[model samples]
Target: MSARLTQRQRALQKFIEILVNLKGQMCGLGIPLVAAFENIGKENTGGVWSDIFMQCSSIMKERNINAGEAWKKALENNKNIYLDECDYEQLWDFGERLGKSDRLNQEKVLELEKEKLTIMEKKAREVAETRGKLYRSLGALTGAAVVILLI
Candidate 1:
């Protein structure tokens, strides 16, 4: 790794850090989704989560994470996961969905979580490698400049 980071690398590292924190907040605390969202602001470590929170619209503003007017707009803008796309509301129709058990719902949620993390990890690693190369080039340039100055 280089001694310094370019703007893009810094941004990617920050993103990965926040994503990992969000994952920990969900899995480590075992908090409900809504509860976790609400609690993100109070937690000092969830800056990325907090940024997403503000983007998602607060409950005070009558915005929902999944199915709502705000959600539709977010989807229109090509934003990430929303309830409208996931048909999360339909999951509540347990009568038709399954035989009176949340097992399927839990499995679906787990699968989604795993997918989310896997994608994030892949992106993070890619950015990290790219940034490492940029940093090496920059470090060599700086070293050459110093040698010329000293000579």
Candidate 2:
């Protein structure tokens, strides 16, 4: 498993991935969201997100990087194209909140899956134990018969 990321980075990554998928779908129809995010990237306010967005793009360019990079690229490309800083912040913030909630929901699902696995494992163990006792009893009976024949 990959190491965990900070809440902000995680949120940013989620937003990026969502937008990328949406953009990809739109691209098939020639209506990509790139222009809208680019406008957001162009804005200089809303903390250091502009720099973060650029970095995200660079990171995404690498073969091993994940959704975070794509998000960065989306923001970078959006600058001077679609959104201002305030707009970018609003979108980014919204995405961040959504990401966190999504993550939490997924975690709950995984936990339930694990619980099911544990239940299955316990059932398997019970079956094996029962089989083991039956085998042991059969072995003892066979040994007793062999001794009687020898006598």
Candidate 3:
């Protein structure tokens, strides 16, 4: 479970990186935000992250709402099984600032979120490694004890 959590955190970090790059593209290349999100959804298929981006893009295009609101709605519509409440809260905070400011400010928000996720991912990786080893050792000991008792 810890390993899965680490993977999810890593995925989220990558997603934020993509968002930062896409934001840059939107500013530099004059690409539409909806198209950027669509591209991200296309690039990252077969994941909850992709679904969120696609949903956000659809909402933005259909309802003509701000990106923050679209992101919040997308998050609400798609629940990521791997993430916890704290992770969801962080994501919600990030979504609150999405497209609510200038390009630099948006980039700053993404970078800060990325930094936080990086730290969290590292900590989760350590816990997964340590706890995995401990669980394996405990399992082996339990099996040995059971065998001894039976013999």
Candidate 4:
């Protein structure tokens, strides 16, 4: 509704666009930045989508802008024209967590694989023992038949 709100809206919109571009510009830079951006709206910016919305709302209550109409108009005509600094620390923290989780998962998988191999080896040994018993039984039966025939 008001010119100030309109300008702020454009600024915030441009900031979001810049953030999106910056996220893809680097391989390791994007994910943490995007996550931090999400937190910005929730944690820093009064849980609103942008500061422009909050500004326009305050203006509307005081008859500065036309009660949410300007907010809608700003959305239509907004352009992002700036790049803001990202929260590097949070990104690093998230990446660290991801790295640790990946390592733990790989270790667990290897442990399971080793256990599976051991079980397979034990099963093979059991099968070999059974086969040996069967062969001995057959040999003894054959010897008994020969002895009986001779007697």
Among the numbered candidates, top lDDT falls to 3
Off by over 4 Å in 1: 1-34, 54-107, 142-151
Q: Can you write out model 1's per-residue Cα lDDT over 27-131, one digit (the tens) per residue?
A: 566554445445655567643335444433454246543423432343234333222323323223311322122444544544454455456446545755788
Candidate 4 lDDT tens digits, 80-116 = 4121122222222223322123434534433443354
Worst 10 residues of 4 by lDDT: 81-90
Tens digits of per-residue lDDT for model 2 on 1-151? 0111122333344444444433333333433223333333465542345544444445444544444346544565556432335445545433332222344453443344335434544544454466656767888899999999999
Misplaced by over 4 Å in model 3 are 45-47, 135-151
> Residue 105 CA error for candidate 1 (Å)?
1.9
RMSD of each: 9.2, 20.2, 3.0, 28.1
> Which is the better candidate, 1 or 2, if ranked by TM-score?
1
Query: Can you write out model 3's per-residue Cα lDDT over 3-111, one digit (the tens) per residue?
Result: 5656665666566577566766665675677888888887744356788888989999999998878988998888754666777787788777776677677667767
Sort by TM-score, top down from the best? 3, 1, 2, 4
lDDT of 3: 0.74
- The pairs that clash in candidate 1 are 66-83
Question: What is each predicted model's overall lDDT from 0 to 1?
Answer: 0.45, 0.44, 0.74, 0.39
Candidate 4 RMSD computed on C-alpha atoms after optimal superposition onto the true structure: 28.1
TM-score of each: 0.43, 0.28, 0.76, 0.24
Model 2: per-residue Cα lDDT at residue 12 = 40
Error of 4 at 134 (Å): 1.1
